[model samples]
Target: MKIAIHQMNSGIDPAVNRAAMDIAIRSASNQGAHFYFAPEMSLLLDRNRERGRIHIQHESTNRHIAALCDTAREAHIWVHVGSVPVLSEDGSGRFANRTLLIDPAGQIVARYDKMHLFDVDLATGESWRESNAYAGGTHPVLAQSPLGPLGLTICYDMRFPDLYSRLAKAGARAFAMPAAFTVPTGKAHWHVLLRARAIESAAFVIAAAQSGGHEDGRETYGHSLVIDPWGEILLDMGDGEGLGFVEINLSRVDEVRAQVPVHLNRRVIPPLD
Candidate 1:
């Protein structure tokens, strides 16, 4: 399938971010892509909680999401909206970093809340407490796409192999990992971890990432990548803000699995002695 990945340097305004997404989706469809993928926080990337709260509303009332669905319908392309912050349905006054998969007909096919929250203090003094504002999702999501079953995950979720294993066992052939990675971590672990995930699952890994400096005073490492089942880099949009396209052969999943047979041979091990 032909896919378009939109690498972005999103700012603090929700309206501006929504407009960028609209253009990218329409352009992707016009360029003959069947599916369009975007980075995390595609709609809003504001770090100011006070300001962000003004725009973060319940999914039912989020006008930006509604506009995106219409864009997908008008463009006639499937959309993997990396992740957006939405008010949690539970009245905890917290938000959920959610991924929405929209079909060509503009219907939501699946929704995945980011299960693993990022809470860390880096040596670079980049401390992030995701759980402070957002709640974690309880389940992993597997949704059917034109390319096959697609596994949905957000930024920090990439570090957990167990999630990918579960998705693969459940018949996911490709994984969408949308991220807004800090420069330090991205420089050290991004490519390696993504390649590892693809190799271990023997599945395709499509990662569209936020790049460069942002209006919120944060800089991100931008290399958006598309890795095949064998861990081959198909397309790498290096540290820039734009769209990257790639065509993937679904049959490669079976080819690699047949050669290695890791999926079939996997065993349920007892608690490590």
Candidate 2:
């Protein structure tokens, strides 16, 4: 299966972001890609934290996500609309970072709310407390695809290996991590962490990332990539905006698992206090 990973630089304007995504999707479709993945916050990137809350509440019916579904239907392909800010049911005015999977028929097959919150103080004199603005999810999400069972994850979830391990144990053959990663952290940990996850699970890893600078003046380390079961990066897009694509052979999963069999060689261990 050919998968296209889009390195997108989304801004505060929904119209501009949607237009850019459409062009990228059309290009990928023309190249015969069966699956397309977009970066986190693919629709709008609001710098003003206070306004984000209002925007999420009013823009519950995301035009960009709907477009992705329509594009998938037109191209007869599967599309993962990375992560978008969605309003919760309560009128308490909080949002959830959610990922939506659209099938070829333009129907939503699965939706995953990001479980991990990115609350940290960066060395660049920037601090973020996502929990203050967004609600955390409590469930793990796994979706079925033509390729195989796919485990869903968002940006900060990459730091938690237990989540990935549980998904692998649940028979996930492929994993997707769509992120709007900061340049400093991504440059230091992105490749290593992604490859480590693939090596540990022996599953194909697909990462679609935010590239370049956003309207909010935030810079991201773009290198969107697809890693094979053997931990080899099949495709990589370094910096700037572009698409990285590769033909992934699902059979390689069995071969890699057979070689290591780490999933089968597990031992019950006690947790540290």
| Local accuracy of candidate 2 as per-residue lDDT tens digits, 220-245 | 88999889889999988998898878
RMSD of every prediction: 0.7, 1.6
Pairs that collide, model 2: none
Which parts of model 2 have CA positions greater than 4 angstroms off? Answer: 57-60, 271-273
TM-scores of the models, in the order given = 0.99, 0.95
Q: What's model 1's overall lDDT?
A: 0.95
Model 1, 1-273: lDDT tens per residue? 899999999998889999999999999999999999999998999888888899999998999999999999999999999999999998899999999999999999999999999999999988899999999999999999997999999989999999999999999999999999999999999999999999999999999999999998999999999999999999989978999999989999999999999999999989978
Clashing pairs in 1: none
